[model samples]
Target chain A: MTNIAEKLNISEKLIATLELEKNSLAGTAHIQAIRKTALGSFTEQGLPHRKNEEYKYSPVSALFKSELCPAKQNACAKLTKSTIAELRIPGLDSHLITVVNGFVSEDLSDYNPNAKSVLVYNTRNTAKHAPALFEKHFGQYASNDADAFIALNTAAFQDVLFIQIADNVQVDKPVVILNVTTTETASLASPRNLIHVGQNASVQIIELYVSIDQNASAINNSVSEIVIETGAKALFYKIQDDCPGLNLITTTQASQKANSHFDTHTVTLSGSWIRNNLNILLEGEHCESHLNGLFILNDSQHVDNHTLVDHAKPHCESNQLYKGLLDDKSSGVFNGKIFVRRDAQKTNAYQSSKNMLLSDDAAINAKPQLEIYADDVKCSHGSSTGQIDEEALFYLKSRGIGSESAKALLMLAFTQDVVNTIRIDALRKHAETLIEKRLSK
Target chain B: MLSIKNLKAGIADKEILKGFNLEVKAGEVHAIMGPNGSGKSTLASVLAGREDYAVTEGAVQFNGKDLLDLSPEDRAREGLFLAFQYPVEIPGVSNINFLKTAIAEIRKYRGLPPMEAKDFLKLVKEKQALVELQVTLANRSVNEGFSGGEKKRNEIFQMAVLEPCLAILDETDSGLDIDALRIVANGVNKLRSENRSFVVITHYQRLLEYIVPDFVHVMYDGKIVKSGPKELALELEAKGYDWIKKELGDVIEA
Candidate 1:
């Protein structure tokens, strides 16, 4: 990644810009070496185009324009807590961790800086302070072989937000990583994050992406690698709402050990464009994983979610439910894959993708794939896309509920099963408010 | 008070209700008895402002207001209720929440504030007992996974809660057994008041046996062929629909 190639093989504008960002890479020598390998992979595969197998519906390359570059260092320096406070949904009591354009903004964050049970720092600093731990798992989980975007992020990311929980530490307060990408110009922010939960430790991490300065557009290609140790429990929360000029691509990879529990929820109420790739690897026995997602889009917004659950060990269970409610000309896609290894006997995996379209022009594509090499495993997947039930709507309206409230209610019901899986109570309430607002629009 | 004059309705070019007419004052329970395909349900659908049914020529005056001028929700807010023949099963909307929202919207329309939570729960409990609904069913999704009898009882329960002035029970007795029918009819009878009226549309006379109607009209080919007292339902039930067809033929020739 450090050495720039004289000639480029692909004509993608983002890939060309990535090649030019060779000398500006940050972190330690170890990360620089890994960045080299990742850059090589990205340069070889290039940006995902229209015909790319993974991006058939979401042509990620088309979003890249020559005007879009890495945002400057002092992009949101004028942003204050009061201005960002207006965007907050009420009733959230958590230790706030704010990151502006991938850089940790301490003055904007509210967490304890001297907490002994947990440590939160940018990876560049962590790479110097906690060198051993950083080298062990920094670039280990997120694969670059197939996904060019992940490699592109890894090769060009300047800073990484790192969080580590000590063994047997039960952090009561959730850490809200509020990321605001100021898009006064066409800008791009590739944020790299790593969360390591120690043995028997439990925590919740909420990654919220919101946009400001909407005169121009921005793209945030973020990658977060989570390591849940033995007997640990984690809840990964992602909420995207009221993002007017943000195009987001996120890949979250979680590796669980024996007797670990990992639950992830992704809710997208408003965004210009969004794509989420969640990959869970259950390597040890008796692991449990639950993935729930809800995306309610209108206007011309788009959101694509691709999830993969790999059951490599026996006695593991995983359940996934993703639902979408689309209106106007908005579109969405859901692709879920479950793979059960041969030795993973008694594995139980279930996935369902349910979508409802309020308008005839709105569309959705749902695909569920399951592969089981073990005979004793129980795995099933169901995908369904439908319009709002006319009978149900009439039934509601006939009861004195107006059209707007009725549609919002019905859309909330369609997403209730998935939204209910949100573990945080206040966060769940905030999500309901956000979802209802989006639906009513 | 309710009045329907020269109501003609259909579904996408296929006319069903041709020159239908009816009139009922306040507190009058009108029973519309008709055979299958006689446009009985179409009349109920059109009255409730269902978008599928287009009224090409007609006027419905309810409480001195043009009913056709209001949306279905506004009609409900104006004290019109339609108990569907086959109630829709909404999977994720709890019966209690649905009721609360309906009451809130209706109250809002009437220039009143929302009911307090304590009062709302109290009202729910009272309404549940009217239809013998279990306490658990109030928390469950609206009519979801409910038995046939339970669904009908839920409709009556909803009708009890809303307390509509003009309640249209469209074939509410079609799928009820004797015990369930008695329970549901008992709920409706308890809700009947001097200020509230009902139009019970049914094929059988068994329901009329419980909640006797003020008037029974024999409908044939989208028009009332015979109008008489409540005994007319018993006559039609015994002689079947052929008697009405023959009676209409004689009138047409005259």
Candidate 2:
């Protein structure tokens, strides 16, 4: 195995090094056990290459060249006041959690401690303490058979977040998780998060990613695993507005039980290269899942979205819609797949991907597919990629709109379909403002 | 105030309008009645500066300016408006927002300040009432999911908002019921002023009965073969365009 690791290329070498380095954590038995199990799985599977079906569009080989060490736990290394001020949304100052370089900082977070049903633990050290609880749930859902990146992420789980909501508890305030990356050197960082919602519990979680420095070419490989127990509901929103020099790979895997509902919205605005994988597994009957995303790429940015909805039980419903606006030399890729097992009868699934190319040089590759093995199911998939309507443009121009303002108006209208899907009013307004700013530029 | 002399236009290499001539004065409603493929829409598109229609020869003068030299947007700012037969459906852009932008843009072109939001909303309400458009429909995306009558009324509403010096309604009466025709015609009548002119392009005489053009022209084979008073429309409706074809057939044989 060592000889095979040495013979492999740069990405393989990085994976091998990460697998070997997991043993040197010198943490408690639980952390060690989890790391060893993940490393073993990674060693058996290795990193995914271009030949892998799931990662055919996103290549992660370039991320392995840089060496990234686990961030040190420093209480004084908190986010600045200016940075916190800039991270303020319209109505999101009450419940916020700021994580800098994978570690949660107390000064930057505003979560109230008096909430009886909500519990927030910095599992970076908790995993070392509670070995049984950590081992029981960690790395149990994401498989390493097809995705090498997920395997590598499991193998190198550094700082982990564990959020638990008690049974039937409803949190009125939304939770905002701000992930800020400020690195001057070439490095890799993985921020692992796990969310558990008990029976009949409901919550809203917002994740924001921003870069502090522009010169550093950092690699962000993060994973968020969520479990919605029976009759639970979870709404997850992720906003990726990182600097153009960063490379990002994020995976969100969610599991729902009977009568549960889960909704995830991902908005990608800026990144040199980004790949997002979202998977919703309906493990019980009468489960509902909604996946919505919007990506606006300019210049030479590349954004790819690969999503899957697995209906394992009967009477499950899923809806997915992703839209992309590509300008300049940017490129976009969207591949959404829905699967219904043989026994998952009465399944209703709908998926659509629409893309608009602003320039002739910009390109988009969209594929929305469905695989249904059940006889009593309603499933449909559609994809369309085209330029803006010339007649519409002429209509606006003939109404005295200038070329730029006309383009901006049309682009804003194009993105409204996806923005209207947001159920949260504040978040929807914020997304609209960000989209307007990008289109104006 | 508008003159098109020896105007020849076409899409690609196939010419549609050959040596067409027309003159429209201020405050006059001139209706161009033609059969299919007679280039009625082409003349309106050319006047409104649609780039798809290439003018091979001749020129169009609008209010002493070279209309052919301006882009569609510039021509629009110069007080030229085309009420399309098939108004575009722009999803996500509310009708109020679209109209405000259009009005603001035209005002800016004329060296005026932006309108106050309160004043603009007031104007929207007024014009919307003039067209009998529902307030709910005005708040939605532009012409999205609108009925045929609603779309035509929305076009008239926009024409009223912009208050263009020259308005061309191209087949505005097509696909309209009698009730819709009355509402649309009433809206046009309310917007009629001595300072503004209109060119109503239609195929049937039914629309002419309501809008009541001052002059009516019979266009065949891309050129106007005869011109007369408003009664000509009634005559053409009775004769059914074959009279002009036979009259030209004898000329060609001679």
Candidate 3:
């Protein structure tokens, strides 16, 4: 991989850009050491080459050709209330946190006043206002060695988000985190988020990405670190529907303690290139974790979802189900790994990834792997890729449905399993509406 | 209500319905009985506009319109229904939602306003009981994990819900037990009206005991070889299909 990276030499310009941004990137003196460590790691690793096992399907090295300027301060000051209203989920009452050009906008956000124990703040404010809380959990869950992108985001992100739910507090409403990217020219933004759910606390978070300028060619590299403490229950949803010119790479790492329940749902609607890495670590006994993803690609779009569920303790259960619908010349890749360590006895893990190709030119590649070192563990993984069921289509169409509507209904039903995992009714309905619209086109 | 004139249809290169002719009037029930390869199911499929069977040379008129020219869904919208011997199992699609969509599409084709949600649910309740389908099964994926009896009963349930002008049952009692057969037959009998017609295709005369047909036709090879009153079903059941085959041996050998 290093030899291939040396041959490509695509990291020289990126390294130079990093060096220039190093002096300008703002952070307190306490965070400076963490930043230096991350930068050192990224400098050694450079851009991820195709030879790297984690990025074999998504070639991040090729996207390094353009020299992107870092996002400037106050990039979305012109955004008005009407734009935010258009993006809101109808009938869903939520606490909105807006991130524009990787910058947090407090003015355009709606904080839950009734939930006084829940604190939401950007990284800078967290560092200034809640230094102890920020220092204890910010960089603990996400490691720099996992991926160079996480290291890059840790080192160079201009803005980082921090969400904290107090122990024993049950949030009545969901928290909607809207990440909007807008740029006048080709630029790069790395948004880092650290979320902590205290003992026995329950909360739901939805992340939606929106782009203002479709032709600006923006690159967003984001990292989210979540910590679910003992007895905590958390649901995290990530919905990505960015512009065609954007390159999105997000790595979400969550650590669950004893008896904790954590689940993540990711739905990628459309993007030129998207690579989402979701990792869950079950450290204590009796922990439950689930990861469900749906990616629909068309018109030369490409998406790759790589998931890992690590069972490190006894009596843990984890399940993963990811589906893809590829049409036109689009392609999709799903690589899921479930690992049961030597001490993780009585562990049960099931993983399945299914794909449906709608056109002759559409394609999908799936790799579902299970590695169980423990003899007492039950682990299995399966993957299937094929075209839509012809008999199912005929069954639907013979009942008075038009051909187009029949096709759309089948596609919707195929994705309905993952969509049903969303506990929020309005959010699930909104996702269905978007899926229906995409299928019609 | 339905007419087939010298219809010639087949799958691939082999012809199944060779110059078949049939005429069914309103408020009439016709039963077609035959041996295993007598094209019993093919006739039902051809009437339902299945694309796999090509009408090489045929004319089918349903209520004054050319049924062959319409698509399968259009045929369905035109009040034509076929109760499949093997109901398709579509996972992830709820039975209620499927019926709702089908009813909505049919209503649209007829230029009727969309049915109200209350009325639709009421109709579902009324029709589901006709086939003795449980509420849980109605809420589940269409025919998924359903027992053989449940699947056949669900087919009748769907037919009852659609309320087509012309209904064709293709061996609905193939795998059904005695109780399921009674329930399904009773459901079909309840849907029988003055304006509706039926063509029941089966091999046994046992089903005819429940939903008695007005006419019983013995089809040998491709076309009808014998036509008689309801007593014909009992006679054929007692003597078996050898009587018809022996009578039609010269025609088949030709």
Q: What is the interface RMSD of each candidate, in Å?
A: 0.5, 0.8, 1.0
TM-score for chain A of every candidate model? Answer: 0.94, 0.93, 0.95
Which candidate comes out best when scored by DockQ? 1
Q: Output the better candidate (2/3) by lDDT.
A: 3
Query: Can you list the residue pairs that collide in candidate 3?
Result: none
TM-score of each: 0.94, 0.95, 0.94
lDDT of model 2 at position B165? 88
Could you tell me how far off, in angstroms, the CA of residue A294 lies in candidate 1 after the best superposition? 0.6
Q: Model 2: per-residue lDDT, tens digit, A1-441?
A: 643343355455556667667766544566667667766677777666657776666655545544555444442333576667678678654478877766766678888755878877676555445434445666677775546667667677667777778899998878888877765566566777878888999999999887777235567778888989999999999998745666788888899999999988999998788899998899999999999999999998888899989999999999998999999999888999899999899999999999999999898888887898999999988998888888899999999999899999998998887888877788888898889998999
Q: Evaluate model 2: give its lDDT.
A: 0.83
> Looking at model 3, how many pairs of residues clash?
0
Q: Estimate, for each residue in A168-270, the C-alpha lDDT of model 3 and write its tens digit.
A: 9998899999987777766777888889999999999999988777334568888989999999999999998655566788899999999999988999997
Off by over 4 Å in 1: A1-25, A84-89, B249-254
Q: Which candidate order results from sorting by TM-score in descending order?
A: 2, 3, 1
At residue A127, candidate 2 shows an lDDT of 47
Provide DockQ values for all models, in the order shown: 0.87, 0.84, 0.65
| Predictions: Cα RMSD each | 3.2, 2.6, 2.6
